[model samples]
Target: MRRGRDEQGQVSLLIIGFAGVIAMVIAVVVDASAAYLQRSGLDTLADGAALHGADLGATGEDVYTGGLPEERLALTEPAVRAAVGDYLRRVGAHRSYPGLTFTVAVDGAESVTVRISAPLDLPLRFPGSPADTTVSATGSAVSTVD
Candidate 1:
């Protein structure tokens, strides 16, 4: 049997290619799962923060206690931001997610929205995977009087 130069290292090249592909797949899966899980956790946290911003924000306690001075309920921008910040600090969100950033928005007088973002570190450093990425989640809440 006669062997050509092309055939000599063909098997080795195929093995290396397959190995690279497998490593890339693993990296993608791990990083993707991490991002997804972080997003889910952030969603829950954002929901809680939104609720806190709406209920414990400026004039929030007064309204809940039936002590509002005005006929309508209103959520002030500064108040909502402060409330969300306090809530996150109390819950240790900053400690849990390093480099966490958040924003609070008031949708008129009835709704408060909380959006949180954080940098995600990849567990696996593959050829195409970024060393760091960002994940974010948003939550909103409305105040109602019965």
Candidate 2:
């Protein structure tokens, strides 16, 4: 009879334990969503930078082939660098996250290729796990020949 009376309290204790587990699950969900949004933003920034670089590359190629005005070639690299730099600065400043960096690379002549990499930090991982992510975008364009 004594043991049966103590058993009544076990149900409430089990419910309380289950509630704590639910709360932790919700926290993990929120952290994962935040990390995903940040990564998407970084990817957009990379895409913009790559497009700008590709435009510059195309202009340079056109100049070499006498397809575009000579002045356009002269202005190409500086303008592209400016645009990419500005984009990086804008995106970086907008985020309050830590450990973010953008790397840019431009290549190709007639067909120009621009590559941008933006590093991000992910959240809500298993215990003792590293959370780092990189979002990359590339844009390519070919110069029109005269």
Candidate 3:
């Protein structure tokens, strides 16, 4: 009739359960931190791409309006696209993750925008195809009339 011996097993079970919970919490913390870093990086990439594209567009407009009538729209669009693409690739979106996509568009003569998106796989939450998150930036610069 010794109650102390029986209580020892219960203590062990509780300890094991607490340890498992602690491990799970640590894993969650690490995963969340990594996701945050990835998100931040993507945001920077989007901003850079948009700004570069916009600069190109704005410059083209300035050149054309500054008595350069021979400059065609096709040349401007391609230059913007190439600049955006180069920025995106250098920023690791095209090389790092396969679930990322970029969309760049020329919005008129003085504006350009770039959209960057990625699908993140987050476990311990609703399970399914992860939701796609997108970050976009638009920049506009106008030519000053002399």
Query: For each candidate, how many residue pairs have backbone atoms clashing (under 3 Å)?
Result: 0, 0, 0
Kindly report which residue stretches of model 2 are placed more than 4 angstroms away from their true locations once superposed.
1-5, 57-83, 90-99, 107-146
lDDT per residue, candidate 1, 1-146, as tens digits?
98756667789999999998898888889888988999999999999999998877746554567666444467777888998999999999999999999988898777999999999987888665666699999999986544
Report the lDDT tens digits of candidate 3 across residue range 27-108: 6786677677777877777777777765554455546566543433322567777877876777766667566777767655
In model 3, where is the ten-residue run with the lowest total lDDT?
Answer: 137-146
Tens-digit lDDT track of model 2 for 1-146: 34544567788999999997887787678766765786666556556666655555455444567656533233355545665667566666335544445444434333334455555554555454456656555555444434
Model 2, position 54: C-alpha lDDT score = 50
Which residue pairs show collisions in model 1? Answer: none
User: Which structure among the candidates has the greatest TM-score?
Assistant: 1
What TM-score does model 2 achieve against the real structure? 0.57
Report lDDT (CA) for all predictions: 0.86, 0.55, 0.62
Clashing pairs in 2: none
Candidate 1, 84: how far from true, in Å? 0.6
Better of 2 and 3 by lDDT: 3
Task: Report the number of the highest-lDDT candidate.
Answer: 1
Q: Global CA lDDT of candidate 3, please?
A: 0.62
